[model samples]
Target: MPVPAPPAALDDSPSARRREQRGWYFYDWANSAFYTTIISVFLGPYLIPVAKTASCAQDFPGMASDRCVADFDKLVAANPGLGYVDVLGADIRPVAYFGLITTVAVLLQIVFLPIVGALADHTGRKKELLGGFAYVGALAAMALFFVEGDRYLLGGVLFIVANLAYGSSVVVYDSFLPQISSPQERDDVSSRGWAIGYLGGGLLLALNLVLYLQHESLGLTESMAVRICMMSAGLWWATFTIIPLLRLRNRPVPAHETTALRSVGGSFRQLGRTLADLRRFPLTLLFLVAYLVYNDGVQTVIGNSAAFASEALKLEQEVQIIAILMVQFVAFFGALALGRLARNFGTKRTVLASLVVWTAIVVAALFVAEGQALQFFLMAFVIAIVLGGTQALSRSLFSQVIPKGREAEYFSLLQISDKGSAFIGSLTVTIALQLTNSYRIAIVSMVIFFVIGFVLLALTNLPKAIRAAGNEVPDRI
Candidate 1:
């Protein structure tokens, strides 16, 4: 297929760029509903119960006639090896299914995102690709509403599709950072995007929380209410994505390169070249490593905090929900506040400072007594303060070092580091849990990731990295 030239760039006036930035922010708003509602609040809790039902039927055939009436906890406790569904003769634990599916999605992205980025850079269809992936992901997420009874396998498949699309859309979206904003404006722009995303995601989550809490009064089954909330995220994602699709403009790829590297096969070859080219930018590569390590710690904490609250702290489900809501709302202001800090203190220093806070938070987790809701909330509050800032700054900083004309390709690699490292922290926690039989020790062990990442990041010379990538260094960076 012939790769057509992209549409002209948006007007270069300050107002025009501001308009583009506003539109770009909406993509963050649109997609975050998926992260907050489905991934963060609902899916694991909902899907695991569904998987448990399937596992009950498969492992305890007697319960099949009763619709799996056995108490899941008691059954698992008694059997110690129950609640597993066979996947091609492999016993897959019900609780592990979500992580398994997530791992699969990340692995797929690792293999394919670079190609997607290469294609976007070559064809300059970033806006189209962003909208396409967002809508596809929304549809996949919406399909979760139908995951009734023992449809855990169906849920897994849909989640993989949704997650893969979500990650791809984000790569394309982040590529727009360098395109739409000058180096000086990136920190503020990226932070605003994250802030708005928090507000959007938090608003939906608040509504969902109400729906979930009052399901009985609302004449809806708890499962059905959860399903509706999940579906609503998809609807919200699809609805808001239209803003960016309408407002964002695509920059044309150079004519000679567009004609020469138009094919999917050609994009793959370009990806190969990009991989080989990474050696030319060691500082950029080192920053990615630093990000991968620290961000893994961040992701692990976010991913496992609920489990920690439930298992180690013995917090109620309601308390956990409230804490998550706090994080969501507080993070909105936190992102903006951090952006301003980055403006004054520099993005690298601000992120490093956030890492220090993260390490402190994990350490503090060790001191929260079991069943102490207030103490747990205090820790969560601290986490919320730094969560958005660290991630937003990291995104903006990475944008600085990416090679010109290869924004999408490099951001694709960043996306890999972003999504691909969660398992590492999880594994570390798992190992710690196995050895110590203490969730506190396991949670605290994540401090290592932050320490290592902070050390590496502190050593990285940002101006050098930027210049090494043949890009101009921003004054603050």
Candidate 2:
């Protein structure tokens, strides 16, 4: 098939712009499968068993009986601290190995994503770049089906690649917001994308959960069922990505582009320039900091909620799964509802309001006692309402403050905050848990993030920030 010609400029006609926006939404629907099924649901648990197999073979050759391989969990419980594998002469727990791999991926994105953003801006090939990264990530996700037995190393490598690609693609994907939608339209457009993504991811996760729960009846091993779910997520991602690649057209390259921006070295230099240039946009920088801090809290809450429920509240696994599914489906409506709220109240104000709610949620979490599943469910519902809204509105609001021609570069910096700041919140939780021996204290510690983020964002001048970036201040904001 012939490649589509890049459009000389964004087609601003309502119909044409709407068509592109619709196509853009599908990319969210596409990539969200990887987030939901692979990252959130299966990979870590699956890899633990694989890593245990290696540990059993190497660390306990005498104990490498059938039961050792089949009942690694029981073996670990019995042995306590002996459940570890030697990797590069270091003893690494299976769970620690997974965390290390994830950290490595985030670090790689920190280094490479800015360069990718610079390249996208220079070449005006974001559509191609987005598709390329998405497909590579999808292929890596698909390869997870082949990881079994003692193949944890292979799984780790594939996960790192897929995660890096996923993060890079998102930077390019977010850069499209300014080009495709007018300032007044960004909140609704971004919210719709997020909402559709939640629906798609939830649908796939629900199906996978059913398949996993029934694997024995279907004559499938649990491992095989998980592997199939991972591959299905990859297939879903790659298949739906075709829509945006086909429908979204690249804007014309800037007419005054310097020759230096045409090569890899140029991209690196441009990234450096972009980093230094950030000082020129104080409100943008402030917003970025606010986003990083609060988003870290949001990520921490979402990431550790299951652990808190399991350990602190003593909720059963089935109840936890039901709550997760509820969050997924409820968040779909939440994004839309909050988008409407932003339309009426302004994006910045709505996001600030969400931050207040986030603060209240963490504080409220401190009081939920063991076996209070109903209270836990109510908390999850409130989290679902704010989770998608905070993130989607923040994305749109940030788009308003970035310089016109440097959208990709600015969004890449935002992407760093999005992907990199989770560690800070997680570390705080770890420290809180260690100091207090209480999961409730650890979870509620996230309230600091929301409080700090709210203070910083509340002080930013949204209309002035928009005007400083050479963009129109939207009527509402």
Candidate 3:
């Protein structure tokens, strides 16, 4: 295939753009609630106290087994490196307890996402997987209402399930971008999805924030308010998700006449063949490597920043919520602006710019210390600026390199690749914090991933990949 004239192939008509944007937006709106409610704002903070109590059974089983805190107290009295305990004097750290639960969840996704990708392509059950995972994740989130005291273990269990669903569903949702849009138009479509997701996640988080801060004022206990927020997120995920399933057309799965076991076996075998395509799909491979590294940094920020701020800097909960609220809206517009930039300057340039901004933010973070709410809040705006832009543009750029009809499967492998990179950022934070006991330094170190990703991304042959993928057209020289 010859290099495509992206302008002509993109179908820049208002009608085409509108349809692509709408679908993209709806999907984001449906999924953002999980990131906002369960992973970031609500669950982590709420789980901290409970995990301390639960960890006693495992961490100090010889002493704390009876009342859950007896041995914990003894260990503390003996001054045994017990910093993991909370203000109420309860265990959470070496375990990263909640993180451990979700780490297991991501591992499930690393294996499961790729298989589901193959299944979605072979079976044409893309939306089914999307809807199914959305509800399952939601239900697991709602069940979080039951997590209390020693129930932290249960919370961990539910988190694994909920996150697994969320991860699996995203693979399919991301895959749909390339399938539904022409090669050139995918960025616009992907951007709309990201913008809408940010808005949706923001909206629910905003309401949940109000509910959280004013639980007693609203005639609800803090625990109940937390539960209600968790439940609402699930319902929100379930309800809004129906829109795409109803409106979108389903493509039938490939009609390969093979046994089910053999078909499954073949997808695994073909994994190696897919690797071969990587060398040919140079930009796609480079972009994947870039995304793997940068997204690790991004996910680390999203997943751990609040905890770092709260635990290390000793930030008030209200301040964190407000900053997160600001991030949501800022991200919504940031994604929109970045998407427009991609349309004008191409995906690589725009995404690289976002990465540059992220590098600056992390570098600036090194100087932010103590309970500097005002400083962190200011930094939050910078975070919001690049947050949506990098993710949306990366998705769109990768979408251009993928062929049609393999969205779910390809994106599944992409998700797996992405999750695999997370270990790097997670390890970076862990090693730094363990060695230096410095969350501040750990937070600053993530910037290296962003900088390196941006430089590597600049060198990728994206135009060549587009041409090889049969997505390119002739130039009108």
Candidate 4:
């Protein structure tokens, strides 16, 4: 595929670039509701109870026989707290299922996102592609409203589809960063977009949490309230997406044939070449390695926090929801604060500092015994401080070193590395939970990834990588 010409308006003026940037930021706002409410806070906990019901119904067919509905209700009433499900005579925990589902999704994205990224690089209708994928995911998320009472299969399938769409759309969305911002401007621009995403996600989570807290007053059952809260994330994602869909424009590209099969082949070839070319830039590859390892820990921590709170800490669902909301809102400021930290101390140092904090958080988490909601909240607050900073700076810093005219392709690798790491992280947590039957031990296992990433990051030569990519290194680094 031929590299597209940069738009004169976007390339020439700061004001025009800034205007385009605002539009770009909205895409983060558009998708984060799904991440915040559906994935991070509600779905894991919700699915556990639902799946438990299903598993119990299967085991005790007597309960689900003639009076199926009533029996199931009776069972739930009898055993209010269902811990593990017996599947084929083996015990399966909810956290294990959650980890398995997410790992599968990440694996799927490993194959799927590169194709989307290549298409973004080759095609001109990026706006259409972004909106199309976003809505597909949103629709799947909306379907979660119906996943009640042992519909674990439905929940799993919908999450895989939604997460695939979410990750694919992100590839296209991230491809726009290099197009919208110059090298020097990328750190702040990326940080601002991340900040906006946290704010949008937090706003929706807060409202949903309120609805959940007041469900009885609103004449709704707790189950119905949870369903509505999950559904609203989809609505929020779909509704907020209109701004970016309308406002962001695709740049002119030299058109190329992108038939289904042709695009597939092209993506594989692009991926192979990119992989081979990495040998020429060792620092960039090292960074990818570092990111893959540490980010696995990050993704695992975020994805499983609610489950950990419920299963390990024995915290109420309300407390978990409120804690996640706190993370989202606080992360909004954390992104900006980290950006300034990067300015003062360099991006690499700021990120390193955040990693150190992550290590501390994990260590502290191991000591947070069951029912210690206050300890969990305090630990969550510290995590919020570093979450946005680590991610935003990582994106901006990586953007600095990728070769020109191949932003989409390289960022696709970053996405793959991210999801790939998640697969490992999720699997590790699941195995730890299964073997040790303790969340604290599972949580502590994540520290190895950070330690490995931190050591590798310390060895990375950012200045050399920047120069090799034919871009000047930011003085701040």
Per-candidate TM equals 0.92, 0.88, 0.86, 0.91
Report the number of the highest-TM-score candidate: 1
Q: Cα RMSDs of all predictions?
A: 2.9, 4.0, 6.3, 4.1
Worst 10-residue lDDT window, candidate 4: 64-73
Span of ten consecutive residues with least summed lDDT in model 3: 86-95
lDDT tens digits by residue: candidate 4, 74-109: 554466544456544656765577777887898898
For model 2, give the RMSD to the true fold. 4.0
TM-score of 4: 0.91
lDDT of 1: 0.84
Query: Which residue runs of candidate 1 sit more than 4 Å off their true CA positions?
Result: 1-10, 61-71, 256-262, 419-423, 426-442
Model 1 Cα lDDT, one tens digit per residue, 245-310: 998988877653436345676788778888998898899999999998998888778866776776
Against the reference, the lDDT scores of all candidates come to: 0.84, 0.83, 0.73, 0.83
Error of 2 at 402 (Å): 0.5
Residues 121-183 of candidate 2: C-alpha lDDT, one tens digit per residue: 877788889999999999999999999989988998999899889989999999999888998
Q: For this target, which candidate reaches the highest lDDT against the unseen true structure?
A: 1
For model 2 the TM-score comes to: 0.88
Q: List candidate 4 stretches off by more than 4 Å.
A: 1-11, 62-92, 258-260, 417-421
